[model samples]
Target: MSSHVKLRKERGTIAECETQVKEIRSQMAEQLKSLDLHVEMRVQLLQDLSEFFRRKAEIETEYSRGLEKLAERFSSRIRNSKEPQHSRKEQDLLSSVSCWHLILNHTRQESREHAVLSDTYSNSMVVRLCHITEDTGRLSKKSKDIGLQMQEQLLKVTSELQTAMKTYNQYHTDSMNAEGKLKEVEKLEERHMGKSADPGLGQSGVDAKQQRSSTLKKMERLKEKRQAKFLENKLKCTKARNDYLLNLAAANAAMNKYYLQDVCSLIECCDLGFHLSLGVTLRLYLSAQSRVQQSQQEAVGVLEGAVQGLDPPGDQKKILEMNHTAFCLPFRFEYQPHEGDQVCVVSAEAQVRNELVTRFQQLQSRLSSVSLETEEVNKTMKATLKALLDSFSFEDFSSSDSLQTSQSAESVKSSGSDPPGNKPNIAKRRANQQETESFYFTKVKEYLSGCSLISKLQAKHDLLKEAIEKAEGIDSDPSRLQCSNRSLRVRKQRPCSQYNHKLFTGDLQQFVESSGQLIPLVVESCIRFINLHGLHHEGIFRVPGSQSEVNEIRNAFERGEDPLTDLTDHNIDSVAGVLKLYFRGLEKPLFPQEKFQELVECVQIENKLERACHIKKVVGCFPQAVLIIMRFLFAFLNHLSQYSDENMMDSHNLAVCFGPTLVAVPLDQDAVSVQPRVNEVVKTIIMFHEKIFPGARELEGPLYEKCMTEEEEYW
Candidate 1:
């Protein structure tokens, strides 16, 4: 049942009504107190929420500021950079520049969005919540005030009722006391009359009668006073009772109104006002957050679309097209005669012969000096090795005179004759000898490296001499000289060929003879190109070139055109591929087919010195042209391999790439079966080119001895 119905059924007497009123008032007061506390708690919650949003706004503002600064910093750097934006060094990054710029733009946009979000949280959400808190708090305070006023009015009525009840009880008690006194006096008078009726003791009776008469008079007066007091007390008590009844009724009515209407209205107002304002404020918060989220979502979608639309190749092509002038082919150099010698026709053949003779003479002098140094170094190394060996044993000193001339030999003989306790000295001497041996080996490597240098110089020397001889031979023949002069004139006038002339698929010897070069022109050109441009290129020989570019370069070379002279349009790999293609298409492999097995067997020898010697012997059987080309090519390869850290093509990798191209196999033999041996032979030749080729006689003692030890370990 409802509280109102229950209160109505429980209301019986004034006391019961008052008791019920007290309980209802107590309950309502507690509820009001609870409502006040709840209001305060809600207000505090709203304050805390506002503080949270305020802090969030601060954090977002800071984050947005940081993002803006970051984007601005990078964009400024990109703008202020001094280097070309699309140079070759930056080509790889050029395609992504637009994407990076897009990211920066979107990041700035996101910063703006966050700034707006911060404003929303600080101005919109927080403001609305504060308003709601204020409204709820004001409503709660007003409701509490109204409830307190009603409660105070009920207390006033209850206090009046208590005072009236006290007055009525006091009056009734005074009236009852008076009535008892009057009744007691009447009983005494009746007892005195009975005594006067008796005959005995006349005088005492007369005295008693007199006393009784006086007492009667006194009793009559007292009765009259008592009767007056009783009537007045009765009237006063009736008035007091009437006032008590009126106050009780008034108190009951006041309490009933308070519990039934006032308290209920106050509680409902507080609850409804607080909840309504809270609901509105929360809805505002949600709406603001949703709007911010929707904005951010749209921004993110746009950013995603931009990110997804990035096209690297298209960007690269566009950049290339825009910078076309930067990539134009450089002009060729033209001959310019001296200012005053325009008509002075110089004999080209005589000029060429003089240049050749000068180079040959220079190389010849260098060879003589280098040969003398090699002999000196060889002598020193042999002496060091012999001293090291002789220090260990005295028996090798065949004569006592030799032992007497050597300190180490004398020490060995003395130690051999000494007691067993002197073996430590002998051991110490042997350790010193071993140390000397190590030093000897170090010098031997130096000597061998010198020999290798001499070999290279010797090769250049021989090439220059041949050119000079060829020039001299042409000069010696009058008929050949006239033909050469006429042909040279026609060649200078001839235009470059446009069609392929089948230069690659020819015999190596034939190409060398036709070009009057120790090595083919194609080989020389490719080697020069790689040396100039691709020595430090990673995976120089292993990485495949673009097939179309390789074919284009190959056709140009086959037409006797110098495609490699201007290499801006070609990559290093393409030129390397052309070189490999020329060798692959050769009519006869550089190493003759019949010699393939012998070379393979020599490479497989167990002793490194013997293996190198045998391989050198077999390589010696090749023609002079072949030897010259091998020296040229392997010399270039050895130099190139020194840059293995950058190019990643060491001797092993080069051998693997060129083994099949340079070495020939018999038809009866499976190329796959002997493939490992072929690569081994080529690797050995490249590594031991200084040893295998006859350049310096210094390879006999210490050089070959060190080779036997160190190269054995290397193999």
Candidate 2:
């Protein structure tokens, strides 16, 4: 029973203890709550204090207004009093009583509120203190964190500063060493002994070397050209020497066979076989005297033969009649003065006239294939006229001549008139004839005048003037006479003014003949010329068709034969030859300036070329304008081709010297105008190129490609 009770008591005690602990914990919670409650009460007190202060400020303002009103009322009363007997103390006492009541009441309110305010301020002060303590802990933590970060940054900056210090020290040492070295080098350079290179010496040496090379090259070229020229000259000299020897032998042979006497005798021969092929021109008049002697001798011989045969054959009378008929036959066939035979020797001799005629043609073929001019040859015909003259002069001396017949008539009457027809034979015939009457060659002398030398020379000049006037014109100047197919120019005997209104005119052949056709006329003119001048006879004379065949043809013309038709059919030609001689061009002009001289020479060369072309064109044209135009076209084209070739040569030279850029080529439009000048420049370049490299040709294809690749420039 005791134990049970004891356990109950213990349990009760334990329960009490446990209750106390719970209450204690509750009490602690209440204490914490009371602390929170104190903070809340403090906050509420602060709020009430602020409210009370605001209300107190308002109460003070009202109290001040009441005091102002009260003072104002008292001052007004005092000032308005009539006697002003109130004591200053009494007024002061009344004003003080009112203030005492207001002060006591204000003091009571303030006392009442001062406790609440004091408590509120005390609580706020305690809370502020606790906040300050918490803030101090927070600032301490921030300071620790900031101090650690700053220390790390400062260590990094210290490392960088150490590197910069090391670099600055090294730079200082280097600067000091460099300054010392600069001073030492300056001293060494000032004491140097070696010489510096000269500026111009190397250039002079190069020029000297170039000059030597050029001289050596020139010597080589000169040697080669000399060899070539020597060989060429030697060949020409050898050919000239052989030609000279051959000509000498031929000339000697010709000289040995010449004889003047045989020529005279041969002229009288009847044989026509002795042709003139020995390459000597025959003088046509050389056979005239021999011919006259032969004819006279033949006549005398015939007379002698007839006399010797005087027995008189069966047909002597008939033969005499035949001889008389034969003598008159010449007169019956005699050529008249017009259209008989006339041919110009000048036109025949022209070179251009020989297109179909070979240059090697015989002289006789060239001159005598044609006859002499008709009017002159017909009127003066030598053989026929001579025959007439001879017959007229000698007939008077013949046995049956008229002069002898008169003598016979007188004698016959004196012999007592013969029986009607009773005439003696030869003896009686002689007895009846009287002495011969005189008739001499004095008749021939009356028909002739002037010496023979003057006459022949006059005839030749007359013939020349006639020919010149007839074939070309009367122009005294050769240059003025240049035209095609012009006929002979024949002038009036006297200038037109001398003939009044009648102009003298005739055909070319007749005009020349009007001067004179008599042999005596020609002979007399020749005689006058001979007396005037002391020229050798052979030196100034030229007779046409001097060969035998030509003479026979001339004799045939005297007997009334027409010759022009035969001549025109057999041998004639037309020619167009330009005169090449120019006196002015031959005397080349001189110029003092070398450049001017060169330019003049160049111009002259060009002019000569053009003139040559013109001359060739004129010759080629002959008698046709179309032919002249064609020739001009071809000639001008040839000149253009030559100009083009020169252009190419210049281009090649330019290409070699100035690279391809400066080649002597002109652009499309510029080419037309500057071609001539460009050609000149190119010509100059080519000359220089040849000077640089003789016998040189253009650069090869690969070389050309390389050169042109440098850069092409258009001029």
Candidate 3:
């Protein structure tokens, strides 16, 4: 019984201990709950961060793609364009095609860098962040599971302890009740034993005694049963108390372990690891960004270097060097007037006289105006200089101004109210000097401009005066008239003067009759040689031959030598130049001046077939010799135009080269003003040679056979 009582007393202390442990379990569970919430928030944050990086990477990739496309589009345009990339006048930085190409290249490089950055963000930064989020979530779930399990374990032990305590209390109450019933039964029996025996009524007393004995037996039996019951209950109470105490100790130990080690470990793993991993992931992201920025900086540096390296002059020089042949100067118009026309002769002389007089009067007027302007500028410059000089003391203004000006500057410095080192006075003097110098320079610039203008006018005046004197001399000289008539008399007299060479500048009919061929030998030989060797030559007639070589070939032809027979020793350009020079030196152009307007008007017809017919009719009006040569030359030109890709001389280019030479205009007409029409006529002739000259024979076989037959007939 005493053990049972002591057990019950210890049970209350154990329950108190369990209650304290339960409080610890609650604290540990709350801590774990808070930790789980923090981990969840952190995971969400990391997920958001990963998504942000992913979006940024996507944007960067898209931007990079756009930049690449922009670069490629411009690059393709530059590559495919036929026009020159740079203009001759655009001689500044960034004007070269190379600079533009470099800029495109830089853009492409930048795109590549951006693409790399995108890749880094996607593959390195974003991926790392996602991995961190995954790991943090995984670890947080694991920690939360462990924490819940620990709390459940503690709570389960605590529930078992409570049930054990309840069983112990119930057993203890039954044992105490059984003990009280036994004590009550024993007190009743003692009272019965203490009662005296009364023999008053023998029979009643006997019956009473028997009843009291039976009662005593029953009471004793009940007392014995109660005592046994009390012992059993006390044993059960002790066992229950022991179980409750054991469970209480277990719960307490579990709670202590959870709060002390398990909970701390869970918090450490979840909270510290989460923070550390997050920081590492963020650092990795920053590193990736830094690498991207570094790469961007490198790209920018390279772009800046390319920009700094731009050299417009060097690029222009390189372009010129590469395309020098294509830059050959075009042919100039050579004036070739027609002969044997009295009306043309009178009109030419009158035109020359009027032109010379008009030019002389204009030059005289310009020279006077320039001279007066120059005088005014000189006077203004002198007045400005004199005014500047009079501000200082000088004995001789012309020679001593510089010295006196220096002295005056020193004197002003010494006489100033401020000290010698006064900065304000110095600045004021500098400003005044700058103003004075600016005024002087302005006057000097005006004077120099006036001088340049006067000098140019004087040169024009001199040239005009010389032209007037020469024109007057020609008008007064009888020799000029003889020279003018020399071409007409050349057929009868056959003058051999240098100016009247029989083979060159001679009558085309005379040459044909003399050579006993339909075409002159010079024209035939030049055309045959060019057809054999120079047809595919670049720039053919557009690029002129050396003057000395051309003159030598011309002299040989004029001297009646067949210089073109062995053209292996001659340049193709010189041979072509000889042909052009022969036509330009002709006393009459292939197209006569009298029919020039009619030919031009025919070319103006809007319809192509009608224009060709009209031009053919007008061309047929020429002498047979003219018609045959025109047919031969145009046929050859049409052949040359077929190789226009190689020679760079199509019908238009060839016509520009030969228009002024093959066609003649009246002296009263400006050759420049009439050149476009002439070029159009020549181009039309070349393009429509077969249609214009319908019966023209093949240049190789039939033409040579016709030439042979004609030569035989002439012989």
Candidate 4:
């Protein structure tokens, strides 16, 4: 079956054939030696005869197997003569029928056997001689035919050559006549030198050509350099983008882990059950509601920052109108409220956030520096502060070892098994250690009683430090060297707002770009988490990207076997890749379907902790404080301001990319939100998606309107 083996077989057969050819030729020669004839003609006839014989053998060989099969099948019938017959008459049938069949089969078998043998051996010799003879004959016939064709072609060529020769001769004669005229003209020209016109025309043409050539070369060089610089800039941008993405991913991963842990701890702490009343429960709920709304407001603020940063042109009056139209689609759901139900929730929510925000501002103003550091700090403290505030009883400051001993004593008293008349023994035992124990308790009580006075002094010192710092930063003296020093806020300044301004023209665009940059990194992190946790779409932390959202339009085109024409083409079924996944702690409702709920929890945790610790929305992000209390307090506040959940979809009826990064969450019909984060998410996603796959927003008018409305409300 292998090629090498088959090739070897073919080669061996050819060699055997050549050997047989020599033997056949020798045998034919001996037979021909007896007849006298022309050596070449006799040789040709022998070859022809052999060739005919070989061809007959080849024909038989082609049918050899079929003949053998037929022979084998009929041989048994011929031998037995007892197989089924068509005729009714069985007697007097000649036995020679069997003999005749046998003879026929023998002849067929002989024919096939001879063919195989001759084709395998004799045929080669016969074929070779016949081929040689035929070749010679064909050569002779061809030579004669070629001689006739050549004569005709030669005559045609001779005629053409004669015509050409005559033309050349005539042309040469004319050229000689022209030369004589030229010689006469030359002599005339020499005699009349100043008679010629158009002198230096050729030179001028040469100069013009040279100038054009030089200009082309300069243009080519300039174009090449421009193209090269463009390519270099593109490379630099790509690399910068990659670096930014990597850093963003790392920072985000660390932040999210810490955020989740803090949220879980804080949630558990806040959920701690104790003695409660209806008023207290209501108060907690109201506090929680306000905290949630403030989060929504701040999230909107962040989104607004992002939108303003993208540097959108301010002449967007028409754009704004269109955006509004897009957002103002008719309500489609059957349970559409009479506006009261929705308004009730909105109004209560909004009022709470506003009130809470105002209170926080008031509280901040009351900070005389000490209270800023310590929420429980007394504003008008004196040396008696220790007696009034910092003082604690010995029992309140009891050591764990002492408390354990007291508990043990109570347990023993309950047992009531002490011997009678042992009062003297017990008194003697206690009398020795009473002085030492009393001394210890007294020292601790004195320290606790003296603490408030020290604190008051410390508070006063902190107040002075803050005043000095604030005064140093302020430019109250207009005449001072104002020319040199710059203010914190400036035109095109550094430490760019991490939170994108969603309204200042470019904020939404900036949010989109910033989040767009985040997407790839987020996707990679998602993949990494999925792998590390062995997670599917089951619970907390699912895969975040959606291939369908990314390539829905392309998918249609691919199905149709046509090229996708545009990104935001009406046929686009998807607007983004994965935007929803699990936050680490809240494991229920994992995928996009449960995104709204998870978002609520993430934002809720972010909110409660902020309210409990007096963290406000104005400075909701992280604080510079290194203390654990401050770190956690402001950390939760930072999360709350993200509007991670509070301001997201209320209807829960749309596709949302629910992750820490995406601004591309597209809110759908009946989609409600305490805040309209999805609108911004969609805007950001579309903008960024387009940067890679250009012209995505071939139909972005509606999106702009929806996003603007949501952003406006938040702002």
Candidate 5:
């Protein structure tokens, strides 16, 4: 009975729900049709505005031409009239008519151009707004569809529940009916037993009672099974409903998050576009300023020339006043078309230039205001983004945040009242943030399309480009030739060698700062210099700078001039070259290039004892002075590394750049024959460089292997 009642209730609810669904579908369809109509209206509005501007321009042109024709007819009538007294007055009236006509034409042209520009800007703004509205409309439609889907899911679950309840009822009724018949039969058996006391009849009655009890037990088992099945179906329906709800909530949240993220991204794009526009505007402003300044200079020059042409005996103050008048008076027009026309054009140009300067100043002020507004908008956007990030624990918006981290119904139920996936506070905060974000993006779009900020910026850029071309043309003019003047007086100059005298003074700090990694080239040059000069055994070397200049520099230093500050690039190179030669004069050559391979091979031995013995033997072959100098060089490099990472002179990398220079081939052999030797010496230098440098640690195993592999290929 309960099952039948549930079935009836479900049947009634389904029809009602279907009617609601139909109503909702109709409402959504109407909304979509309305949105389409709105879009079409916006497009049509733009078209109408465009047509209005076209008609306005045509009217202005026609009006200007009509005025010109009227002025001509008036002038002709005045010229043809025979009245002498009226002739002069008519001539004046005709001149006024011509002037008025010109003014009307100029004003009309300016107004028409301004109107067209304004219409274009307005049209662009409308289009941008339409795009925003369309996006919102789509979002609304998607939300409606999700609602419809949820309704459908609820109805399906209701139908399944009705069927399960009906099955449960049928099983239960059958079980109860069996028990009722068994009770009736037992009462009948007691009445019959009192009339017939036969043993066979009594046994038959006992058998009948036993059979009924068995039937009752079977019915109870069958009912229990049906009840278990019904319970399972109920749990399934409940789970399905919960899942549907969770999915709907997740979808809603996801859409909101997506919209907010897109808005943030759009805001960022706008910020970038604004900055780029500002940069372009700034360039144009600078170019315009330059051109204006140049024009002003030319105008001032013309005025100065006019001043110079004035009577020489005139009073100085009067002459100055006359010059000012000459500058200001030329913009006036003469009806006679006299020689003053050229001066008038020039003066008019000067006035135009002045106006341009004022306008440029205004442009700069507007740009600054725009920049400040853009910055404020960006800050607001970032703050909203930060709030969103804080409220929702999303690692990144680059992927689908909802799809990847959506919580199932089971997880939500397990987590109890406060599910980890969705927080009420967070959802509320996100909604607020989303609203603010939409408003900000709307503002950003308004600013972008406002008075055509981007278009104005582009115009400025084009103007700047044109100005640059003009400037370039002027620069290329043949009239402005570079003078080939030269000074005849002699001055004391430093020799290259004198600058290098300090290299052997043992100033490691100066060496690192000046030469950096160029130390290798300097060293190579120095070594070749020593070899060429046969200075290997010399205890002293001549300084390279001019003697007089060197003495002067020394005196200045003695007078407390700082050496490092005084050092120049040439001086640094010369010092490095000199230092290289100092190595040749060592008690033993640093690498002992003659035995480079033997030394490296000794260090490469597998047996520690054998390797140590061979290294000792190789060291003993060189003079003790060479070992001392090698240690000093490595320590200096380590110190230099601390100061600058460039010269670095680290064990592995320094060897690569300077390796070949360190490898000295025999006089009778070419470099190719000594390639193996160079490799060995590079290895030897790196090995000892690590061991001798105080702070050096053994190379990491992988890095050491990579270095060795590179070295083999390099050699």
Candidate 6:
């Protein structure tokens, strides 16, 4: 009975101990789980804090850079203005007005910092909660060491949280203070703006307004003075005009009084004589002639009386008495008649009459002196006449000229009848006939030559007309042509075609059309120029065509014929090659490859607006030839796209065919070296086509890929 009681009690005790151990283990596990959750939260909060710091630094740097850029832009605008000093002053005023902007920015920065700190503080609380969770596992294992370390870490975290909170509160206060200052600054700036808006009001006192008032007063005075001067000048001009009129009238009166005497005398003479009606100009002219004739008659009478003995005046006296008439010259002034004026006219006439009488007396004295000389001349003339009569011979005076001419001819012929002096008449006639025949033959030869030239010119004109018709027909056809075509292509192949078979037969027609139909003719002309100038050395630069054929083609071109249709494959290729040669001879390339690369880079800017601006800047610097070539390539690509749609050569095929050929590459450099450049240019050209014709399909093909890859490999 004693043993059973003991066993029962022991079992009860053991159950109690087991129950206690289970409760303790459950509590510790719960604590450990809570600790782990706190640790994870702390770690995440620390990471977030680090990220916030990084973002804050980035924002600050970006803000600073943006501020500097804005300032530079404003400064540049001010400096570039036409009024530098005035603009600078305005810039200063603007800066003063914008002072509030800086304050606002500072306030905003402070607010942001405060917000970030407040967030850090809030997150630090979660970290602090991690420390409150006890780590019982450390209490069990190395209890003192683990507990002390956990306490130290917890203290450190708590201290950092406290520091962050303090900083947050400080930033919050600063933000509020800055915001208050920003308001004050804005109020001050507003007042300054109002004051500046009024031109009459200035910070430099009222000096500017006062100066403007003084300048206005001076301008009013100056205007009044100018008006007065103008009036004085007008008065002077009026007085001078009146003086000129008076002088003109006086001069007219003087001219009529002195110079118009002939007119007055003519009027009087007409009235005094038989008054015949006549035109004024005719009467004046006839009156002057009559006066001159009267003077001439008086002088002639005196001379006749002095030179020869006079016959008695019988029938002439009677005829003169029958036609006797008298005329008088009236003296009159243009204005009021002056007594002295008439006296001057009467005295002048009287002087003339007295002079005439004195001249006649002198003539009579001279005639008496010359009378002896006249008698001597008459006696000599009579003796000469007698000698002439004694020496005259009147025999055979009635004979005809023909009879005399025949007699003279016979005498000359008989005189030349000697062997040395007289050759056979037949031989002389033969020589004359030979000379005449040779001259006529020479003239005939010249006429035949001229006729041949005219015929050749006419044939050329006919050929040119035929060529025009042929070219028109070819142009009318829509089908593309090839060297192998039987009807359209030339049948006769030249030696040059065999040697340059690839070039001659290549598809160069697309690029050649834009240059002109005369490109081949120009090339031939250049080749001729080269040969004539000795620019072509043997085997160095030989043009590939028979000389005669080239000359004929060139002549036809000079005659304004379109010879494009007449050009064979061989000639076309030769001309295309020459075209390239001409480009190579230029001092600078048409499109510099280096500059094109820069242009591509410019257009490749990421920003669309910036890219457009850069494109304008770059394109503006391009040479004229480059611009033209770019336009041509753009057109070529558009046409090529159409050609592709029509099942002709596609974009890639055309690019491959003509891209490198269009741009002149130096022979010293391999074609492979510039193949990529040409391909890029071709792609750019296609892009331009897309821009011009937006509805067109984009370029695509395996051939394009192949070409691009080939070019890329070269690079």
What RMSD does each model have against the real structure?
53.5, 78.4, 51.1, 48.9, 37.2, 66.2
Which sequence of candidate numbers ranks them by TM-score, best first? 3, 1, 5, 6, 2, 4
What TM-score goes with each of the models?
0.31, 0.15, 0.32, 0.13, 0.26, 0.18
Better of 1 and 3 by TM-score: 3
Question: In candidate 5, which residue ranges exceed 4 Å CA deviation?
Answer: 1-6, 66-202, 209-715
**lDDT score, residue 499, model 4?**
40
TM-score comparison, 3 vs 4, better candidate: 3
- Alpha-carbon lDDT, every model: 0.60, 0.29, 0.60, 0.31, 0.38, 0.36
Measured by TM-score, the strongest candidate is: 3
Looking at model 1, the pairs that clash are none
Better of 1 and 6 by TM-score: 1
Q: Ten residues in a row with the worst lDDT in model 6?
A: 393-402
**Could you give candidate 5's per-residue lDDT for residues 1-715 as a string of tens digits?**
9647645654554445445435534543443344344335535654564455456445644553554465457656656777796666665568786686566544444333333223222332233233333433443343334333433433343344334333433343344445455555555555554434543348888887666666666656655666655555544433333222322233333223222232233223322222222222223222322332455776556654553453322332342353332211111111111111121111112323444344434654565566567666565455444433332232111111111211332222232222232343334434654554464445544443332342343333333333333534544322122456653322222112223224333333333344332232233333322222322221112223345543443444333232222223223323333454444333334567567667656645666455545665665565433444344454333333332232223444334334454445556654433444354444454455544322313211111111121012100
Query: Which tens-of-lDDT digit does each residue in 250-269 have in candidate 3?
Result: 44444444444444445543
How well does candidate 1 match the true structure, expressed as C-alpha RMSD? Answer: 53.5
Cα deviation of 240 in candidate 5 (Å)? 4.8
How many angstroms is residue 688 displaced in model 4 relative to the true structure, after the best TM-score fit?
74
Best lDDT goes to which candidate?
1
User: What TM-score does prediction 3 earn?
Assistant: 0.32
The residue ranges of model 6 lying beyond 4 angstroms of the native Cα positions read 1-562, 565-587, 600-617, 645-648, 657-659, 662-674, 687-715
Clashing pairs in 5: 495-545, 495-546, 497-544, 497-545, 498-544, 498-545
Give the per-residue lDDT digits (tens) of candidate 2, residues 1-715. Answer: 8546644654554354345334433433442343234335434644554455456445644553454455456556656767545664465468775686566444433332332222222332232233223322332333233323322332333233333323333333343344445555444433331111223258887776666556556655655555555555434333332222222222222212111111111111111111110001011111211232355766556654553443323232333344342211111111111111132132322322342123213322322222223222333333233333232222111111111122222332222222222222222322211111011111211112111112222333333434344554455432122236644322122111111111012121222234322111111122222222212211111111234544443333333332322222211100000000110011221111122223223423445444334333323323232222222222222222233332221232222222221122323323222334333332333333222211213211111111121112111
Of the pair 2 and 5, which is ahead by TM-score? 5
